[model samples]
Target: MRISTITNWAYGVTVGLTLLSGGAFILSARSADHERQAVVESQALDELSERLTMAAEQTSEDARLFVMRGEDRHLQAFRGDENGERDREQALKSFKAAALLQQEMALIQEIEQDGEALDAIEERAVTAYTNGDQEGARQTLFGAEHERVQSDLLTSVRQLTDLIATRTNDALTDAKQWSDFWGAVAKSLLGLTAAVFLGVLYFVLRRRVAMPLMRMTGIVNRLARQDYAVEVLTDNRRDEIGEMNDAIQIFRDNGLERERLDAERRADQRTKDLILQMMHRLQACQRQEELAEVVSLFAPQIFPDFAGHLYVMNDSRTALSSIGSWREPRRAGPVLTSAECWALRRGRPHVSDAAAGDIPCQHLEHADEMGICVPLSAQGDTVGLLYFEGASDSQAIASARLYFELIAENIGLGVANLQLRDRLMGLAIRDGLTGLLNRRSLDDALNRIARDEQGDVIAMMVDIDHFKRFNDEFGHDAGDEVMRRVSAILSETVGEAGTVYRFGGEEFAILLEGGAEGSALDLAEKLRTLIAATPVTYHGRLLGAVTISLGAASTTADMPSADVLLRADAALLSAKAKGRNRAVADWVERSSTDRRRA
Candidate 1:
């Protein structure tokens, strides 16, 4: 049965048993009260009977004394015995006052008659003794009617006492029996109630609640693990467990759907991995040939039924050029792209039912032709386009579109990486401070000039005089400004024929190509004079004008090595020794003329 049904029954039975037990207890109590009342009545009757016997004995003793002495003293003494007389009168009153006084009416009447007969006998004996009829008084005393009445009264008292005692004992026994029976019934009821409670608890916990809960827990675990094969056990209950079972069944169904979802997740992950791998291979191409190889590798793998190509824009961005091209392996003929190439270059995909008219090329004019073109962007600039063609199918084209975007992104990154590498190389070769060819790039320029058709090259080394004092007095920041202005002047003055280099602290070097010795010396002196005329100011302070000492050397076919650079260094020292601001030139003996101070 359902647990509710069983619970209701158990509750009802328990209540009924409780009421029955209560009724039994009430009956037992009433029986005990009745028994107690009987005992009280019997005790009262016994008390009355004992008091009457004592009263009779008192009267008889008084009468015997009166008869033996024939003295009014004995009668007066009896009358004066107020304590005993009061007790006898109280006893008689008590006998009459009993609750069942009518039931002992015969005993009471017997006692009253005996009392009257004793009074008469005592009077007759007193009269006889006073008249000197001692024999007659003896006869009256011995044959007194009070004797028989008193004996009969005593017998009745004994019988009444016996009845009271017997009834009290019977009541006591009955009270004990009733108490024992009720006590046993109470114990039996308590034991049965305990057993019923325990049975209910065991049945509910082990079978109904606990066992079902355990099975439900197991079902939940299985559901969590995505194992949907486990069966759910549920009784046809209208309680909480029934609701839980239905919920679990719903959960199991949902879990099955979740399994399908998990499968779709794995499939999507595989598709993502495939697209990523293809894009990664596409991005690794540094040259058009590498890109062509990537296309060849992916075209047959990704689009086995269609031809594919990658069309890149030229450096001038005027037209599209084919870099990578592929045809299906089964098709033996050369695939011409004159038909779709124009449409592909227009930054859109094209589909041709039959490649005719606007679709160029007789070879590619087919009804089954479908093509896709996606723009490749690098740093927000369109670098190229990826072109692909395949049989017209929704799923195939959809998958290809996903791959197309990834491929475009990959090519974009490749182009960006190459451009950045070239730019950084240029920055490395140039000076950060003056935008001039730094000392490191001078060797490269020197080697290029040496190999060039320009037959002779002049090298000059220059230094700023007292540049450290200028920095200390005016602060290094203003000094740096001065240096920048000087470097800029040198760059503008030298123009294209010469390249300036910052060669260590306060020193500069220049290479002039195919220049005569006089021209080289004149250029050096002009640089020196111009720098000397230019004064630098810092915070309204006139730091004074500055000048540069320059040294010049020439390199012919004979002095092609970098050693010729030292001649310009030696001449610069000579100019510095002569004065602070000047220009000196190393004139080959043939070019020497006048060595005038500048």
Candidate 2:
């Protein structure tokens, strides 16, 4: 109901109840007024009885005095004789007033009869006094007539007083009953009114307000606590409760969405963490076998039933070499054909799940071995392949393929890094112009050999004859070409027996193992002859032929120092000063050769 309508109804009820209670109060008041009138009448009747009794006593005394004295004076007093007549008149007036005040006919009749009896007694007593018979007057005054009058007077007054007392007591009883009845009725009406008010308040709050408010509060608390499972209760009446219910449903829906997002976020984090840990293991790999082991371990970590072989591509991509396979070696090696080479040369990731389709494999003689291949590429160049087998139940082939692509990417990066490190190290030690060991390598080699307690170690110093003239005549590029050619010749001649170093510009050094002065001098002569015979060509231009003068010494001498190598270099200078394109041996016997040169 509308509040205004409800309020109007309640007001009407209250006004009706008020009018009813007021009528009840008015009735009770009238009952009370009747009781008050009864009280006043009883009190007035008592006053009349008291006055009559006093007046009767006075009249009796006056009549007794007049009769006992037997005097006209006393008779006058009885009639209107000064003092006694006043008493008689007062008694008569009281008798008349008592007659008027009496409501009962029986009491009024008694009063009239008592008044006539008194009048007769008064006449008799007055006649006796007028005759001057004192004795007769006394007898008449105290006789039966006067006694009958007083007895009638007492009886009439007692009857009137008894009537007033009885009626007044009855009136008080009726008023008390009426008061208790009305009090009970008013109390009952008040209690009913109060009960109605409370009942209306309780009904209004519970159905229209309190219950819905409590439900809304409960929903709010549940939503605040992230409990999205609660259901909302609302009315069909299109009010705030309907909107609130809709809002709660939306909140639960949003909570479900957030929960889904949170789960996905955690899953992605786990994947990234696994990849990072896998990367850590990959970094520890030193050789191709170790890399294969890492890849194989990562396979099961990414997918179920993972078995695969890692194959590396050759420089020309015309060959596939299985670096590591996840099983034992077979009894025989399956021969790889040219078709497999062609597939590898195509240089793309290829998958084969079909029973009879061609897949590039050097060892695919068995039908049980089904697989797919993904290439490990670095900067668009295919470096290797990761081959995975299919499961017997179902192929996680698609997911496995994705994993292989990711794994291949990491593999490519790792291999590229390793190759780059090797190249950098090679560049650090190798001579840039000559492709031989630099001075640093020479120092390392000399130190190692000097520490050896072997049969012999020889050091040679070589100087190209007139290298400055060669550079000036043919330009620096041609000079560099000459140096490279000479370095190549020296390296080819020394083979694995010695280490060659480009010590500086126009100068080179060598550490020859297991060599005495004879081996050193023979090696130097070979280098000199080779350079004299060969000429370097640069940019299709013929550069002049070059020759190197050589000096040789041995570690066989006691406590030989690197300074002895310096003596060999000094000897090379002497040889170059004498002539070019010749070997000058600086052996123990070189002192005699040195004296001759001097």
Candidate 3:
């Protein structure tokens, strides 16, 4: 039964028992009142019997005194006793009204008859004594009839007293017995009520309520401490305790679910932290090689089950090549064409899990293999490819596919940044018009050579003879063509023996390391002759026979490395001063100047 129902039943029973006990007590009190009334009435009847006996004895003694002493006082006392007979009569009347037993009433009537006869005898004796019949009065008072009547009256009074005493004693005994019986009944009923109350308290309160509550208290304490792993047993009872158990089961279930959610949240946070760390590392990378290394190192940490290669697009954009691989990937090889990878072809992510009925990428060695490819893109241009294979489960790959694509996107951006930086560096160091090293690069080379200070340095400065006349005659396009043709021949004739640079416009400089001055002059003359013999063309027409002035200088221990290019320029100006289209060496110019001074 339900606890409420049980308690209600207990309450009802206790109330009923309490009421019955109360009623029993009231009945016991009523029975006690009856016993008390019986005792009181029996005492009243006994008192009346004693009064009659006393009156009988007093009148008879007074009559005997009047006859014996012949005294008027005795006569007067006997008359008073005779007048007291009315009191005796009233006492007899009390017996008849008391509702005594019929047998006892008959005894009272017999006693009354004997008392009246005795009273008649006493009155006649008193009258005789008054009429001076002292002898007759004495005879009357002491005669056998008087003696018998007196004895009989006294006996009847004694009998009445004994009867009253017996009846009163019987009433007292009966009253005592009745009082004791009802008192015991009331006490028994009260004891039963108390026993029932105690039984309910023990059985219902202690066993049903207190014990179950105590057990649930322990469970609640554990749950409060967030111990969701603790086992909660099922309760099938149909009581309030059963309801509490079901509630506790629900609470435990909720706690377990919360714990699961918390664990998942913590794991997701950890994964995001790793992703953030990888992104930071990727951002810090300066080269495709370094970015490949970073990706290889962190990809396994991020997706341990996957093994793949980082493939970057080649410089020609023709093919993709793996820069790094992790976890011993076997399905995806070292090189893949753009058309071979669906991810690169479609410029998106593609899964190649054959077990899942997905089409395999053409780059995979086995058609039944599982893999995922993400095309690395930046600024709307797909630049590289990420191929992952060897994942144990397709579901694992599917779940982390987003992170793969995210990592690929960031890596693509990083690769794009590296390529852009390389292109910018190349532009900054190369001449835009002639495709030769610019002045800045020449300075950089000179500074490097000066710092190393190894071997003799030859500096050649060359210029096209009257190069602006071609622009005036054939337009600036023709001048540009002359410069281009001459620059190309210069570069081809010098080959790897020297470094060529276009300082500006038609002016060019070359640096050769560790060459003789004679060799430098010879190479300068060869360059001057080769350019003069070579005809130049602009559009479909031959412009002229283009020749060039040349200046050559070499580094000496006494000369600062920075003065070599100036010395070559000075020689070229000398060659120009003498005549155009001639070659001059700074040493030869110096020698001529020395001779002129000498």
Model 3 stretches with alpha carbons more than 4 Å out: 1-40, 64-74, 85-87, 96-99, 121-284, 296-309, 313-373, 378-401, 416-598
Candidate 3, residues 491-553: lDDT per residue as tens digits?
A: 898898888899888999989898888988889999999888988887789999898898888
- Give the TM-scores of the predictions, in the order they appear: 0.40, 0.44, 0.54
Which scores greater on lDDT, model 2 or model 3?
Answer: 3
Order by TM-score, highest first:
3, 2, 1
lDDT of 2 by residue, 177-242 (tens): 786677667667677667667765776556656777788789889989988777766456454555
Residue 297, model 1, lDDT: 73
lDDT of 2 at 34: 71
Comparing 1 with 2 on TM-score, the higher-scoring candidate is 2
| Number of the predicted model whose TM-score against the real structure is largest | 3
lDDT of 3 at 3: 87
Comparing 1 with 3 on TM-score, the higher-scoring candidate is 3
> Each candidate's root-mean-square deviation in Å?
23.7, 14.8, 10.3
